[model samples]
Target: MPNKLVIYIHSGEPTQFSFAIVNGQNQLQNIHHHHDLLPQESFEEIIVIVPTEDILLTSVALPKMSRNRYQSALPFALEEQVIDDVEHLHFTAFDYQPDGQLPVAIVAHEKMAIWLQALDALSLKPTQMLPSVFALPYNEGQLQIIVESNILVRTGRWAGFASDRINFSQFLHALPVGSAPQEIEVLNFSDTSLAASQDSLFTYHEKFAASADFFPTLVQHALNSPGNLLQGPYAMKKTTLWRGDKLLKISLCLGVALFSLLFLYPTVSYFILKPKLTALNAGIKRIYQKQFPKSTAIVAPKLRLEEKLKKLAGGGDKGGLNQILSHLGQAMQTESNVKLKRFDFQNGQATIELTADSSEDFSTFTSALTNQGMLVKQQSANLVGTKINATIQVS
Candidate 1:
């Protein structure tokens, strides 16, 4: 996109705005002037450069004057109190004085200035927020000489012959025309008619030329210059126009495709393999029935047996059997004459056999098991030589 350029209209008695584009060599290309009433909303985007009385006075050779004298003499020339409602005013002075008593000038308009700032906030382009006088200065050449009077005329050799006549006032600054040596002459024509008067208060330097038809020539020179004024609004209307939801649209499409595949694939698989899966399940059930004749009745019993087996194998149960065995062993107080020969566990029953040297020894052993919460039942007993074989069931 091409760069944007904006120029704001100043506010004054006869306020207006003009602009021109100039090249690196400072030659004007195009010029345009605007004096039409602007919309209130349009004012928000414009940067106004209104005239003011506060002149920036400085000289290359002149001494700096006291602040009191400066204030008394200048006292901002623009009518400020009349337009106090306007906001956002700023002022600066550029002095190019080579002799005594430099002129002071201030540009302002608070409301219009703030409105232009609002336009900047909205990212609009405003290349130059300049006063009408400063803008008019560029209508000619390297040295712009403007003579403000009852007749306003701009004359310059390089500017190629142009003059303009208009109502003049002390409140306005004459536009700059021509270059350094080209003296800009200002004559007061408010009092006398030039046709009948013989006394002349205005004359020109040897380096400058005089002309009566300078306005149209000045305008033509501005048009022919290297720079031209930009048209329309300051900023491009649709540079980075946003378009949302693009990624969301793609994701939605993918999700729909995946959903369709999930349902369709599952349905297709079921139709293709349903019969085979059913046959396999039936065959497995038949094999199980053949292997276990009392399968229905013993299902619960088998679960109980599996649990008990897990406990015996030291896997699922928490050391309860070990604790019971340790307690029983501790309870069996050993009589020197009695010795345990074997211990066996089978089908939820524990068997203990002992050989005793005397009947007292046997009695003591039986009493120990009884005291330790074991249900003892003597299954068989035999005496042979010095050994006694006894089988006891511990429940």
Candidate 2:
């Protein structure tokens, strides 16, 4: 008795669907035609009405048996009534009548899978499903029929068929004489014109305009009917804490985000920092050029500066000529007899020509240079009349 959604599937097409919302009071709240399956509201239960031609509403009488035995023998018992192999069809058996006739619904397994898959795509699962013919109002001793896009004829409480409007008479007359109704009433839901019965096979015939509340009316009858095709393997599975469809969508979105981060981070970082690196390199080049203005081939300015300093200091330190002069002055402070004659520098080495008061003074000056961590090599030496003259290399 809770609010429910009733979906009418047309022409075996998942996209061609219509639905109605019935409240707990059994009143029609909304109706939509050719509607998308996305529902804006919630319902306690959902019932689906499929095209009748796709469902085989028939009955079979069987000996009393346990539920398992009845289910196992159902397919073979109805095998002769269907054209397709029993293995390829799905069967749903209902309670037995007084005469032991079990009302049954049969549909192809492939068709059932397709319908369920379509509903699953929309995240919908219907609790009850039956043929559209059952939606017609039923009366005792009278046949009820409805005409819309197709013709639906309900001859008994649980018997009916859906056919094209053009073939209505052919199928109607094909019914067994003993089983045909004494009176027939037709509810026409379309603009199509209906002609009175001329065959005179029935005692009375009546055609009436379909009411504005047709969807709600049909939904009420369907809910009261005892036919549901969702049984055995076709029943809706219980939903887990997390729905499969929502979980899959979430996982796919996360995968896309991770891929974007991995693919774009390095490229974005390079573009963002490229300008800063360029500015720093430019500043270093300008400072190197300003300090050594006369130098033109400026390859590796830092290394070029180190080479210039080495030439000035004869490979000792970055203080250049000043450091070399400081060391020489200290070495000679204790050797007053040693006098500087000439000084020359080339290729990271310095040559000094010196005069000393005696050989001992010259020896003492060279030893002092060696003790100061400078490589001293005496290139030439001569004993003059009263003085010692020597040319030495220091680096």
lDDT of each: 0.43, 0.78
- lDDT minimum window of 10 residues, candidate 1: 52-61
Q: Report the lDDT tens digits of candidate 1 across residue range 1-395.
A: 22122343323332344433333343434444532322212211222332212212111223456644443333243235324322222322233244454333332444334545654554444433433233334533333433323232323211112223322322123433223323333333234333233223223331222443233233333332322111122222322221236556778999999999998999989988999999987776664565455667434544665566556545323224553365457656555666768866544566778788766677777777677666779989888776677888765
The alpha-carbon RMSD values of the candidates against the true structure, listed in the order shown, are 22.3, 23.5
lDDT of 2 by residue, 253-341 (tens): 99999999998998899998999999998898787787677767568887877886665666447334656567789889979999999
**Model 2 TM-score (2 dp):** 0.56
TM-score of 1: 0.26
**lDDT agreement of model 1 with the native:** 0.43
Model 2 C-alpha RMSD to native:
23.5
Which stretches in model 2 have alpha-carbon errors above 4 Å? 34-39, 195-198, 210-213, 238-395
